[model samples]
Target: MRRVLDLAWLALLVFMAATWQFMPDLVGAPQQAMPRDQHMAVMLAVAVFGVWLTTRGALLVARLAPGLVNLPCRDHWLAPERREQTLADLGDRLAVLGLGLVLLFAGLHYRALQAAQPSWPQVPDIAWTAGGVALGLIFALWLLALMRRFGRLAPVTTPRPVRRSSRSRDLVWREVQPVWPLLVVLLPIGVGVGLGLFFRKADDHEAWLLTALPLLLTAALGRMVTEVHGDRLTWRFGWLPWPRWQVDLDEIVTAEPARSRWIEGWGIHVTSDGRLYNASGTQAVRLTLRDGRRLRLGTGEPRELLQLLKSRIAGD
Candidate 1:
């Protein structure tokens, strides 16, 4: 349903672009003179896409569970001191966005007065442009500060060891050796970005480069699929692919996290339950054992994968 809605929105944007191109004189004012129809079409399409992307990005941020929403018998692992720090960091970043919008609106009337004669009255001058650019940089820096604070919170999730017995138990213990799916996907994109940046003219290059950034990131993520082996969890990126996590199979109790196509969003996400793993806009399955622990992994073949893991653990 979300996919269908997204496609419909894109189609509407395309239709609007076509209308703008064929009806530029109708859209732009008489004084400014019509931009070339082709150029206008491209610009309009880009603008629509940019706005859609920005809106979607904000939604993704909002979906986050916020402030250590999960505690799986591992509260001891959490950074006791960093909780307040994380909240403070979030408040500061949110303030930056708030202040930016306030300034943007407050200056709008002044900017409009200056551009009254000009057809595009909304456009600001070089000084205002510079100020806008500065605000953007400050916003990015504030976001980075928040990310660093979040990183500090992550180390607190270190796994704890558990006691095990030789008695048979219904368990599903499998490890991802190397994550190579992402590197394979990203290599082409990085190459494309590099070529466009170097071969194209400056004017065309920047536009193409700007457009390529998201594609490049998506490709990188596509390359980041995991490989399940025995006891180790591996994360790969190109030649640098290797194991980043090597948790003992016994250390992993039931690792079930809630994952439903109905609820999970795109890309790899660790849910508030600490049991669900969603890597894309795809299928989901739950894992359970005789013990209380549970694990959920979103895979293309969830049923088959679950069976395989059960069999593997049974053999172990």
Candidate 2:
């Protein structure tokens, strides 16, 4: 059943790509009648609905053929360590798959550009480019959902310690330096800026791409700080006045030390089953919320931070 579903998904992806690539021919002349924003919104809605329906159909098939969809590791999700390992392995596999797809698309894009006629319409080029990006994002999200459905059934564990809430204290503050290795993210931004400057006279797209580089650089270089005040726990990056993330301490269901691989990278990101906010080291703390959402904060002093949070939660 799993293999069948996988093949079906692959076929669907191919179909979508082909449809997008040949849209100009299939739909006749391009229509710039609709505003770009409106057109993009409609396309996005259609893509989203298509993914949701495909996922729903896959689930229905699994329900109808439960015997075929059963996991090889029957009790794997029951063990915390095993579950984590399984998720991490899946993440690594997905990352490799994403990289390969990106490379494949890049090769195809290069070939298309090379074979293009001097007078070829730009509308088809834009359509094909947008379609490729949309397909990549949708496929990645679908794979993530598939993995989560397979592995996110682990039982909840006990919460870790947090510092006690003291009425006399206005706040509890803790800050750790982000991992130095995360700084490497700046390398790509530098390259992007250099290329953009070199091609400044070429197109408006280069200017737009350049304008976004600073924001990415800021996010990549931002520090992670955790602040606990009153009933709120806030996580912020850099000197940003507004918190990048915050949660009501009351909503926290569990907290524990969690490990991540270097490949997981840093900064705010979503996993198949949780959200990660890491700036540095692989060692961090994971928080499970009352609503089943998970958040991870990368920290160098995992034990100390965990104990403080545990005590705080107990005190509260």
Candidate 3:
């Protein structure tokens, strides 16, 4: 039943994206536009072609450069059963929240449309568009929930060893050239500010939402802090500490110095091969976990950090 609902939701999204090219017309805006059906067909074709190309390219690259591709794993550092339970719990909550929000928004949109105009013709189009948006949001929330529940569930063959001694070594690396990560963090804020300026005349309620974008983005990506304490490797944004991820030394199969491209940028991102938690510098240490999942942590001194981790793992 859940899978069927998910597929239906995805189909609705494809339909909406296809017809997005005619959104102005659907919203009753005054403009000369292409025929709605014809425009939708073109857009649908383009979107499908783009997705196909991207998937094909990714697969080809994965085959050619296996090192670049990180095998998917159930657990990053947490025990497999525990991670699964955590995800299932979180997914249930998010699924309920998403469904409720969709219903609430759909009702509000319908009410607004009815109140604005006592009309027949535009109602269907407007309702359809609004419902599509609501469905898209619900789908996104549900998808995220599912990914969280399943994405990190790898079997924990190597259990994290309990440290008997409180004594632990710490290795910290500051970005020698911090400008890029700084710019990466600020770019979104700049764009948000630009949008706010362009829409200065927007309603007060909408303006408040627009104003919050930069602050939210800054909190999410502002400053990257990477630290290794004992057998645990963790990284978090300087502004927000609650959402940090960690890697247990026991799970690490190997740690080696590696280089990242500028295109990879800086942030917590899931790459083709594995998950990356990076802040600044091209220098990084890639840790291949026992489950085959890879984690690349950016640092100014990749070689030193890599050696430190390996030595610690050996000592353990």
Compared with the true structure, the alpha-carbon lDDT of candidate 1 equals: 0.44
lDDT (C-alpha) at residue 5 in model 1 = 35
lDDT digits (tens) for residues 14-49 of candidate 1: 554444423433323467544456545555555455
Candidate 1 runs further than 4 Å off: 1-205, 233-247, 255-258, 285-295, 312-315
For model 3, where is the 10-residue window of minimal lDDT?
A: 1-10
Deviation in angstroms for 185 in model 2?
5.6
Residue 39 of model 1, lDDT score: 45
Candidate 2 to truth, TM: 0.47
Ranking by TM-score: 3, 2, 1
The order by descending lDDT is: 2, 3, 1
Model 2 score (lDDT): 0.56
How accurate locally, in lDDT, is each candidate?
Answer: 0.44, 0.56, 0.55
Error of 3 at 137 (Å): 12
Strongest candidate by TM-score: 3
What does the lDDT read for residue 78 in candidate 2?
26
